[model samples]
Target: MLTQYHIEMNREALGEHFSERALQIITTANINQDRLAGQFGHDEYHFDNNAIDKGNRYINEQRGYILATLIGAGVSPSVAWSAFGRLLHSAQDFYAHSNYVTLWLDENNASSSALEIDPLTKSILLSPKLHTGKVYFPMDVVYFIKPLRSFALKLLPKDSHGWMNLDSPEQGFKFDYAIRAAVKRTKHEFELLQKLLTPEMLAKFVDK
Candidate 1:
């Protein structure tokens, strides 16, 4: 997902439940994941290159950290929210960066306008055909070299992130579906976090 969408979706998902400070911290961390060195190559961070098991492990690890930070004494609030944001980034990217959306459409025999289909309903995670866009040289590396970027993309396979991403509206109607999935996934991540948080901890974590 793009940085702006990450910010927008995270805020939309949790803005009402979290304080302004918590939202800021979370949003900052979410954006930083895209900026930080080596993160782009970390398939677990963006669910890129079909690192499914690694992605799941990363999410679980962050969940544990968020719980520990919230329930354990002396951990910084920023630490918890940071983990929260990182987790959301990967979860959100699952929709935008993977063939899951196409698979969903195929299963339902629907088009991009099929917004009525619940984004989270299908258990396509274990599908043998389910895979994310592969990231590779010249294709992703030359992204900053605008004129050559298109040429570079042509060299990438159909399964490459360059061809598969629904990061923006320009991608097509499927971008809308990705946006919806990402927003809902953000909320779902929060709810999953809540399961680990005590009532008192949850209250302390979110704004009243």
Candidate 2:
């Protein structure tokens, strides 16, 4: 997803539950992921290129880091937020990069108006065919260059990221669903963290 939406959606999801300082910490960490060198080529970073297992592994690794940091002595809120933000980035990207929304719409025969509803069922999310767009090169490269983007689209495969992304409203009608799902997932992540961390650990982590 786009950087602005990443920040906006995460804030919407976590604002009421976390202090402003804590929110900023995670937001900064989230944005930094995009700034990493060769980030676009890293399938697991954005859950792109049909890298489901890699993305899942990346998320679990971050979650493990957050758990260890929080549960052990000398808890570091910054370290925990950094890992949390990285995990959230991958989770959010699943909606934008994958066919999950399309699968939901197909199964429900739903339109964009139903975008606010939760799109994931156990079956839909875990479908064997559930897959994300492949990151085709040169075409993918040109697509990022505004002047060449339209031209690139003609060459990009229908199953490629350039064609399938729901990063913004301009991409397609499913942008709303992507935003909603990402926000919901962000909150869900926080809830899971709440469950895992002791009340004291949670308080410190969130600056409560």
Candidate 3:
């Protein structure tokens, strides 16, 4: 479940920024910005100029997903949850809706030993360092790597699964690194949301 703190902080930090950014990357394929917008019953956003390609593919793709989540979570004026983005399932609607057993199952390779955080991943560690308080932490990002990938892979048919393991070690490792990075990003995002909440942030509801 997402907290009010999570919702408000995200709405504050990201709400003000996503539209213009989407306008900047509407042409990218596999994103289907128009279809996604229509799914939410909103009009497709427009670009400032087709020539303003200033960033890398990751910026467009990653933020594109984030923008989608924000739009979905904020669909109503009194939307009770903040966005957990890909980290959560669609049925979730509150913070108390935790499934520790599921989380434990996903990250542990069906058992308990954790993934080793390779020290060689120094450059890739930059994203998760955004946790300033106990609100989120460094090792928490390490815990995210296997589970997040497992979560994403869950979307595929079993026959189409294991696609990532087929890649070169470096490519596999890049995917590995990216999932860890996403956890940290979400944690940082939640911490930012904590900064913008009212006491209603404490209310809870059953996950849908």
Candidate 4:
């Protein structure tokens, strides 16, 4: 149930609730990535699907999972506005810092991103405050997720947290191994999400 018009959600409130919600979804999905991947194309839970387009196949599933999790958690339909806001803020920043990513998108019109830190994932890794630029064989969508792709594209590549370029096989395998780690890790921009939730959204999501 949505609150009356008198109710309001400030950014801080939204961030907290959103963080909680994101964590909830990430956790639930991590437990079931293999089953979910079967729905997509029989490929188990991989962060990147070589068979499908990068931003299209992978991020779409992540977004779908996030949305369904919210609904299952009883998020009021009204919360979508706040979620979109978070997506825009997080994805744009990641892209701006990844220069090689931008050039790849420009060259090929599409790109593939893997959880493993191959040349592909390394090119788009959102670098820590540094000025290095990166480029790939052909410009690709994974390179420019935000302006070029759907808002959900911001939250995907859920494999291998910390940096997009995960250094080892173990690290890559565990990329977003659990949702709480993904949502509550305190490093990624999901940190900026708002947590303010109405009594209704709160009651609904209390399970996690």
Candidate 5:
């Protein structure tokens, strides 16, 4: 999902379920999650692929340690929520940056009953295929040639990325689908955070 969807749209959607202060905390945390990727010189962290394969367990473990450290060190809930947002971002990307959306569409088209199954379970059932082609050269070398890199990526076929395909409407992308997936992922993250923290600790961040 794009940064706007992750930060603004999701925040608005979540507002229906949470308090104003709680919404603010999660939305701000979401924004910081995107920002921190560039700050740590680990932009790939934003698009980490492991989250897709291992499901919520992986996401919980990755951010869980950091969240625990922050709370253990007496950091504010706002600070810990930021770490949680980082986890949310990765989980959200599992749909946008992977073939999960395509598979879900296929399943939904085949039978409406497929909706009875959990979306995350559907994603877990399919192996993520993020890239269709391989580059023999050091791809990062192109970054040194600014315009050349931009031109190269632009010229490459859209299908080069799992999420993009010129043949499908919405370019094989669906904002609604992405948003729904993000919301589910966020809720899961919130639940996991609640389990990891005490009621008092959780209440500090969310209305509960």
Candidate 6:
């Protein structure tokens, strides 16, 4: 997924699409997650191209746990929503930092109308044979070094892995894909939150 300025900007834009209080909670938590705290646990939360199901399941479990805390443990809705936003950052990254976008494009032949990936295409993307350009160990170390990072990134072929590519004209990224993925994930979050709270309570946290 995009990081630093890109992540900040995307989350800010997403927050602007929501209410003031909601935006505050989301942006605050989103930023925090990008920091050291979010990286404390399994890095799988950051990227797992081959194990999409595991990542999705982990995110869902987190959401459910947060919802339970909000309703049963008397945690503030703001706190719960903040954690939810953190989970969202990872879930959203699944598209940008994985081959899912490329696979989707290949399946649909660059058609913007089809945002949903079919089962077969998803399986193909997740296959171990497919190279998603994911970095590990010393390779990930390049992220801290600007020149080295640039050099390392240049070594990889474009469009074979993730969608974000600063060197490309379109930055090797697709706004439509990112936006659609965000909307779908947000809808799932909203639906789950709605089910866990009363109308009155939900209104306090999200715009009606």
TM-score for each predicted model, relative to the true structure: 0.93, 0.94, 0.26, 0.27, 0.64, 0.68
Could you tell me the lDDT of residue 63 within candidate 1?
89
* Poorest 10 consecutive residues by lDDT, candidate 2: 111-120
Candidate 5 lDDT over residue span 82-118, tens digit each: 5666666666665555555556666566443322334
- TM-score ranking, best first: 2, 1, 6, 5, 4, 3
**Candidate 3 residue lDDT tens string, 76-146:** 31222322232221111111111222233344355432233221233322333211111112332332377
lDDT of 3 at 77: 18
What clash count goes with each model? Answer: 0, 0, 3, 26, 0, 0
**Candidate 6 local lDDT, 1-208, one digit each (tens):** 4455334544544554457677767756655655766554544565543445666676777677666655654556676667667777666656555655556666576765636644235465556644433444454445446668666556544532322322122443464564455556555565667788776566655653
Q: Is candidate 5 or candidate 6 better by lDDT?
A: 6
lDDT, candidate 3, residue 7?
38
What is the lDDT of every predicted structure here? 0.82, 0.85, 0.28, 0.32, 0.53, 0.56
The most accurate candidate by TM-score is 2
Per-residue lDDT tens digits for candidate 2, residues 160-195, read 999999988998678888888888888888888889
After TM-score superposition, what is the CA distance of residue 138 in candidate 1 from its true location, in Å? 2.0
Considering lDDT, which of the candidate structures 2 and 3 is the better prediction for this target? 2
Q: Which one wins by lDDT: 2 or 6?
A: 2
Clashing pairs in 3: 1-94, 1-95, 9-193
Tell me the TM-score of model 4.
Answer: 0.27
